[model samples]
Target: MSKRKLRVGLIGGGGIAQAVHIPGWNNLPEAEIVGVADLSEATARKAAAIAGTKEVFTDFHELLKLDLDVVDVCTPNKAHTPAVLAALESGRHVICEKPLAVTTAEVRAMGELADAKELKLMTAQHQRFTQSGVAARAWVDAGKVGEVYHARVRAMRRAWLPPSPGFIDGKLSGGGPCMDIGVHALDLCMWLMDFPTPVRVSGTAKTVFAKGHDMPNLWGEWDRERYSVEDFASGFVHFDNGATMVLEAAWMCHQPDNEELMAQLFGKQGGLAWPEATFSTATNGIFAQGTLTPTTQVPHPHWNEIAAFADCVLNDKLSPVPWTETIKVIGILEAIYASSNTGAEVAVKG
Candidate 1:
């Protein structure tokens, strides 16, 4: 740990702020929560209490002027680009939660500004830090999987609604399942396949659940009338490496066995899986489907992802999860929606 702890300014004090950000930041020895902000002063104060800080403000702009080292943004999808850009322009580093931005243009700018300022910028795709995900990626990198050819990523929830008003609005969320949850599976797929350049995409985002049919989710019932995006999405994305991925995602579907999250990597020689890090690889002349094969010399858990972000900020290291990677995912998601709307395959544009 460094002698000087990084002071953090937080924007957004909702459940994600309380449950995810607070606990995640507390685990780091190099970071400190200095100021908290939200749309409501009450919410900000509540988060301050949980974080053991008395500095609470309803305005993030005021908080940003407090000479903070890094700004942690857990706000809605729409606010990501603005908050991050302001933070970077102010000469503060930033760690934003997933879906980097609602659009590729913003993500590019975020990346560009960070580079120009020599500041650390990271997106919180914490699932990348999962023991199974990390282990699986290592296996692929070590050539244990042997010539990867297919990636199947599934993030299907029975009826899980984001529960936030902004989440269902296309203006705020960009899209539905892909931006909300599918990115996790996609990230795992990309990581496992070594981030190959996607050449073409054919996909659809169905409005099966967006109709707001009567359904119950762990997050509770969402008003269908207010629903503005797709409920299910499927894509066939071809990469420059000659490998193709089958991406499937949904917020609510009639599928029998629900998989809220997971990516299955299939290589020419063997297969690997996640949500529980395990693998099946070919050795000598035999192929195994499910076996206890140690992926690498070490294994890491969820907190490890947050630690990576903190490490990057304190050490001034560029994030392994680059904005270019995030922008590509955004481009894919946008293309998927475009393909669905026009009933034609869409090319991913930078």
Candidate 2:
């Protein structure tokens, strides 16, 4: 740990902030959470109490006025862009929660602002810090999964639909499982493939069981009338490098697993699967296979993610998860939603 302590201002004192972001920052010896801001004053105060800070504000702009080195944004999907922009403008580096923005355009604007300020802006895609993800990335970087041409990504839940308005409501969430859990697997898979430019997307997003009482939710009951987002989504993507990907995301389904978050890639020379973190290949006409075990185990990936972001900001290192890479992921997802609505393949511009 460095001797200098980073002053961090946290925005959005919600579940993610309480569950991971705040705790992760607290685990860092070189970081001190100085302020917390949320839409609800009580939520802000509660988060501040946990973070060992008295500075709490309902308006994030007020929190920005404080002396801070970085802003950790755990706001909803739609709020990410504005919060990140404000943080950058306040002369602070930023680490924002996943689905950095609902659209590629918003992501582009935020990325541009960060670039102009020469600030470290990282998306909190903590899954990349997991043991399996680390090993998988290392294997891909070693050319073990040579020339990935296709992938299968899944983020499905049997019946665990989130019982929160922020997740079920389209206005707040921007999208359902596709933007929530699906983004996790999709981003990792795309990163593994080195983010090939997406050319087109064909997809479907439907409210199969969320708006009715057919399936019982594992996470308690939610307001069906407020459920404006999709309960299930599937998409196919074509990339510029002649690569392709299939993605599935669902909050409720007839699945054996409570949840299955996975990404499997197929390359010309080999194939690989995540969470499993295993690879298969053939050499000299002899088949070979192996599973990669990570050198280190990160009990809390969010902590490692926060530490990485702070290190980048404090040491002038490149952002571990740059917005440039994130835009491509979001672009594919946005195209998927558009295609679903239009009943035709949608072109991906970003």
Candidate 3:
């Protein structure tokens, strides 16, 4: 007889669950798409039909009553806490999408629960699965880029605001690009540096173009009065080991050139970059710096994280994106928001 299949319950049948999670999991024979739940019954049914999922529920709480091995959270940021808690409480593994939770406190609570239960609470930071990202981190860990001291991550956009209402809402998204796009950069940097305890964070958030009053996003404008968050944000994070990172992100900026997404790391030996770029190093007498040059592209699928998660869940293997490291990334993110709020250096608490 075949070993037991890992039955999964999916939450949020919108774009992410349909495009990323379901498709990736379907490729794995040991995993089965058992059920799906969403706020919108129509969308949920559409996804369920396409994925060949049998049980569908509009109420996520009801879906939690099923016998599931894994709970894949593709819901909004605010809903992540309750959904994950329910899954972990039910003795089911959890895989939450990025921005793990909207607040550091929420993430800490989830981590605490997962810890007490001795369950794997994996956060899907899909950027970690990219070939370029994989190569960069592996090279750094192998001491190829020795003693990385400084770095820069830039995520630029011409105003491609997401479609979901919760995306622009501060209470839901946590912050603008600093959380959406910048979170990937933060994870890459911290993971490369092995998540050194951050000492300080200084930052600024601007409502330059797409404020709550004027909602002219790249896709289109929503109700202006309902817009309740930032459009662009930038910050500098300082780690306890004296390493620093300059981070920049935005939905809209005044600059003329638009940068896709770039991460650069500099160390004692050499530096590495992705998306057709170069980062070189110099370890000479006194002065040293790095250079950016065009390099051959490293192709990777956007859905690699989902496939990896499926494999891990099916085989009962440990996830690559540990919940603790995800917490560290969220801690820095919380600090950045706090720094923006109080106009003071936010101390990264645990």
How many clashing residue pairs appear in each of the predictions shown?
Answer: 0, 0, 0
- Cα lDDT tens digits, model 3, 35-63, are 99999999889889877977889999898
Q: Best by TM-score, which number?
A: 2
Could you estimate the TM-score for every candidate?
Answer: 0.93, 0.98, 0.90
Residue range with the least summed lDDT across 10 consecutive positions in model 1: 294-303
Tens digits of per-residue lDDT for model 1, 1-350? 64878898999888777887877777777788999989889989999888778999887888998979989898888888888999999999888888888677788899999999988888888777765666676677777677778888889887776867778877777778888899888887787777787878899987875665467776876767777878789988888889888888888887676555988788776777776666776677876656445454324343566677788877767785878788877777777777888888878766
lDDT of 1: 0.80
Q: Least accurate stretch of 10 residues (summed lDDT) in model 3? A: 291-300
> Which rank order by lDDT, best down to worst?
2, 1, 3
Model 2, 235-322: lDDT tens digits are 9999999999999999999989999999999999899999898889999999999888786887988889998998898789999999
Off-target runs (Cα >4 Å) in candidate 2 are: 1-4
Give the winner by lDDT. 2
Better of 1 and 2 by TM-score: 2
> Which wins on lDDT, candidate 2 or candidate 3?
2
Question: TM-score for model 3?
Answer: 0.90
**Candidate 3: lDDT over CA atoms?**
0.76
